[model samples]
Target chain A: MNITSYTARAPQLVQALEALAQRADNQDSASTLFHELSGITVLVAKKFTNDRTADGMHDAFHLTVGCISLGISQAGIADSNEAKLSFLLQHGAEYVFQMGFRHIKELSALPYAAYVSDFDNDAFIQQRNLKAIFLEICNADPVSVWTGDAVYQNELLDRKRNRKIIDCAKWLRKNNSNGLVKDSELDANAAISIAVIFAVSGDGCIVARTGQRELENLIARARETRPDVEVNWNDFLKKIPPEFQPILRERMEELRGTIVKKIFSKTKIKTVLTELQDHYAGSEQDIDYS
Target chain B: MSENINLPAIRQQVTELVLAGSPEHAEDAINETAEKFGDLAVVEVLNTLEPHVASLHLSAFDGGKMSLATLLIPPKAWAESLAYFAATWDEDWIEDEPEVLAESLFAHIHGVVFGTDDEERRAELLNEALATDWGTTAFAVLFSTAAEEIIEIANDIHNLGAHRSGRTTSDHDVIPLVLEIARTNEEAWDRVLFEIFPDWKPGENELHTRSEDDGDDHEDEEEREHEYAIGRTTKELLLRLRKQVPSKSSGPAKTGGRPSLGEDIFS
Candidate 1:
C-alpha cells in the first residue's frame, strides 16, 4: 500500500491491536493476537542495508530500534482519529527505518542508498537492550545502574528500606577514602550479593543479574544477532569435567573474596553470605567463611 | 537531533510551523534532511510527525513540494490528506465534462493496465472503474488504480533494495516498465521514485535477503506461519485479481470503484 492507504489503515490497525489486546485474556486469543502483531512487527526487521561498516551495523540497528521503540512509547495521546493514525504510522516507520541496519556482508546484493543519518541514539530501551547491557556489565564486574554506593544512597533516601541493605550500605560507604564520589554515589561494582537487590526485585524486564540465566541470555542474544558465531556459554561450562568441580569451586571462592574485606565487619559480611546462599539456586553448596 | 531526542515534540514543532503558515521552515528542514542523508531518509524523519501534517502539506497554499518527504509521507499523513480531499472535492474544480474526460482517460487507463503484469485483471478494473457514475468518479477510481499500480511498482523495486539484479537497458522487468508508464501518469510525483525500479525474477534470491538457514529453521514457528499467511493473503488477493485460468464460475475480480476515502481494500 502507498502512504495514502497506509495512513488510513493505521488507525484501524491500532484499534484492531487494542481489541486483540483486550481479547488476549484467553490463551487462544492471545496466540492469535501475537501472530497478528508479529505479522506487522516482522515488517520492521525486513532486509535492507546502507553504506555503513560492518562494525557500525549492530550499533546502528540498536540505535534505530531504540529510537523507534521510544517513538512508540512517547506516541501522541490520541484524542482524535488523526492523532491515532500518526501513532500507527510512527510504529510502521520504525520498522521501515530498521531495514537500514542490515550488515554489509549480507547486503552484497543491495545497491548502496543513503539511509537515515542521525547522531547516536542513546534511547532508554530500559526493558531490553539497555537492561541487558546493564546486567552484563554488573555480571562481568560489579558495575551496575545500581552499584554498592547507589544501593547505599538509595537506602539513605528511604524511611522503611531493608535494614540489612542499610547495614551493607554503611559498610560500603566506610571505604570512600581515596576517590571523589560524584553525586555522593557512582555506578561502581556492587557486591554480587548487593546486585541481587535489583535482580530479584520482582522486575521481570531484568531476567537475571548474574548466573546461568544471564549467561544463557548473553549467548542467546549473541547468537540471535550473529548466527555464525561459534561461542556457546553453556557448551563451554558443560565441557568442564565433574572431577574438577571441587578444585574449580575452591579457586572460585578465592576469586569471590577480594572485596571490601578489611573493614567489612562480620555483620555486613554475614548479610552478603546470607544473600549468597540463594544466589546459586542450590546448584552448588552454600559458601562458608569458616 | 540527539539520540535521546523527543521525536514527537520535534514533529509537533514542525507540524506547528507547517500549520501556522510557516511550512517553508518545515520544508527547509525536510530539504536539509534529504540533502544530508538521502531521499528515503525522509521516511524515517517523517515517522515522527503528528497527524494532519499531510493535509497541511497537500493544501493549495503550501503545495505538496515537501522535498524528499513527498517520496514517502507517513501513511497517517496520507490518510489525513485522503480525507481532506474527500471532504473538499468540488465538482466545479474541474471544467472538463465527464464524457470528454472519460474519452481522454481511455489511453491513460491502457497505460496503467500495461503497468501491472497481469493485464487482464487490470483491464477488468478499468472496465469496472469506467462503469462508475458517468466517468467523473470513474476518472477518480482510475487515477487511484494508477496510483496503486505505481505504488506496487515502487514497493517491489524498493524491497529488492533497488538492485534491478544486473538487468540493464531493455531488461523488460515489469517494474521499470511500470515506472515509465507511472512517471507519465504521475508527472508531478517524486522524480527519485522513477529512478529506483529494479528487475528480479520469482523464486530467485537476487537480493540474497533469505539466508540458507532461514529455509532450515525459523525460531518462532507460529510467527513464521503467520507471516507466511499474511504474505499468502496478499498473493491470494493478487491471484484473485489476476485469475490465471479464465473459468466460467470464477471470472474477473468483482471489485468496483474503491476510492471511498476510508474503504479498506483488504476488507
Candidate 2:
C-alpha cells in the first residue's frame, strides 16, 4: 500500500558524489569523502523515508547498504571491477532513490538487524521466527513458546525445513487475516483449504504421500524469482521434476508481470497457492479449495 | 590494568551467554573485555572459550547458527586483534576448529547467496568459504544445506547433516557456483561424498557401509522411522555426483583426466 517518490530530493547527494569522484586522485580526501558520503547517505535516506520518523536513522543506514547492494547487482553485467565501479560512479546515484525506496519497504522483513530489536543475535531472531512458524503449524499462540523459555531439542526444524514451514505459516497467517479460515468453518463437513494439509487418515499408521511437491511449491517457490537475471528457461525447467513443470511455467509467467525493473520482490510466497487452485480444480483428490 | 580485571569471571560470563544462546550479549562482553582489559585479555578469554565454543549446540530449534557463529568466531578465528566477524567472517581464516567455524560460515554464505541480488559478491563469499579448511564441508553444506537442525555427529569425522535432504533447484546462481566448485576441486569432491554419506568410505559399497538403525528398541516410532529414513536418497544422489566427478578412491584409480560434473544440472 506504500507508494514512493524521489524526484525532488536526490540531486544534492548525486552532485556531492560526482564531486568526490572528480577528486578521486587525492588520498587524504578519501576519509573526508567517506564521512561526507555517509552523512549524505543518511541525509538523503531520511528525506526519502515516509513513516517511522523516529527509527529514520536505523532505516536510513540499512537503506543505504541495501541501496549500494542493489546498485552493485544492477551493474553486475559489467565484465570488470573497474567497469562496475565506473558504472556505479555514473549511474548508481540514479538508482539510489529507486532502490532505496524499494528496500525501505523490506526494512521490517526478516534478516534485517534493524527490526530484530530485542534479540542481540541474528541467529536467535531466525530461531524465534521459525518458532513463530512452528506455533503457526500447531495453530498455537505465537508468543506462547517463549512463555517459560523451556528449551526442547527439535532436530526436524532445521534451516531447510524451517524455511518451508515459515512460508506455509505466512500463507496461514494471511488466510487467518482474510477470514478464509472462518469462511471455511461455516459449512458442514468442510476442511480449510490452505496448502498446509494434515489428516489423521483415521489410523495411527501413515496414509499419505510426502508433502515434498506441495512443500516445494509452498515454501521454496518464492525464492525462484530471479527472472531479472539471464537464466536459460528450458534448462532451468529440465532440472525440476515433471510434476512441477506446469506450476513453474505458470510461476515464471507471473514473475514476468510482478517483478519490478531490475529488482524482484513479488517473489514472496503466495502465487502458487492461487495458481495451483486450477491445477487441482475439481478432481477426486480430497484437497480443499474453499 | 590486567591484574585489576578478573579474566576467569569474564570468560565464565561470556561463555555462559554464548552456550545459553545469548551470543549478542557475549559479543558485547567480548567488546567490553577488549576495551577495559585490551587485546591480550581478549586472547586469553578466547583461549579458554575455544573447545567450549566448538561444543556449542547449533540448530534452528537449539542455539541459532549466527548467534553460535558470532560467539565461536572470536575463539576459533586465526586473526590478530579481532574486532569480530565482519567482512572476514567467511574469508577463510580458521587456523583450527574448521568444522565448528564452517557451521557459522555456511550460515553467512547462505545469507549472502539467498539474501542479496549481487551475483559477484555471492560468488566471492561462497568461494571464500570453499577455500577455507572447511572447504569440503562447505561443498556438502551447499549441495545439501546441512539442515538447520545440525546435530552433534556420532562416530563421524565430527561433522554436519543428520536428516535426509535433496533438491537440485537452479533458481539462483549460487547452486551453480557450488556445483562448479565441487566439479573443479577434486580433493573437496572426495571429502564431499564422505561428508554427505558419513558411512560411505569413497570406494566402498555405500549401502554396505551404512549402519541401518532398524529401531527395534526405539520407543518413539517417529524418531525410529526418522533414523531409518535418513540419507536414503542422499546416498543415491551422491552416487550420481560420483558418476560425474569421480572421487580419487571411486574412479578406477581416479583417472587423471576425469571430467568435472557437467553443467547439465547447473546451467
Q: What's the C-alpha lDDT at position B50 in model 2?
A: 39
Candidate 1 B-chain TM-score: 0.33
Model 1 chain A worst lDDT window (10 residues): A137-146
Leading candidate by lDDT: 2
- Model 2: how far residue B17 lies from native, Å: 3.4
Worst 10 residues of 2 chain A by lDDT: A198-207
Error of 2 at B67 (Å): 5.7
Interface RMSD of each: 13.1, 19.0
DockQ of 2: 0.01
- Per-model C-alpha RMSD: 26.4, 32.8
lDDT of 1 by residue, B155-253 (tens): 565455334422334332233434443333333222222121122333331211122355556566434443321121122222222221122222222
Off by over 4 Å in 1: A1-290, B4-6, B33-41, B58-66, B74-80, B91-267
> What DockQ class does candidate 2 belong to?
incorrect
How many clashing pairs per prediction, in order?
A: 5, 2
Q: Model 1: what is its DockQ?
A: 0.02
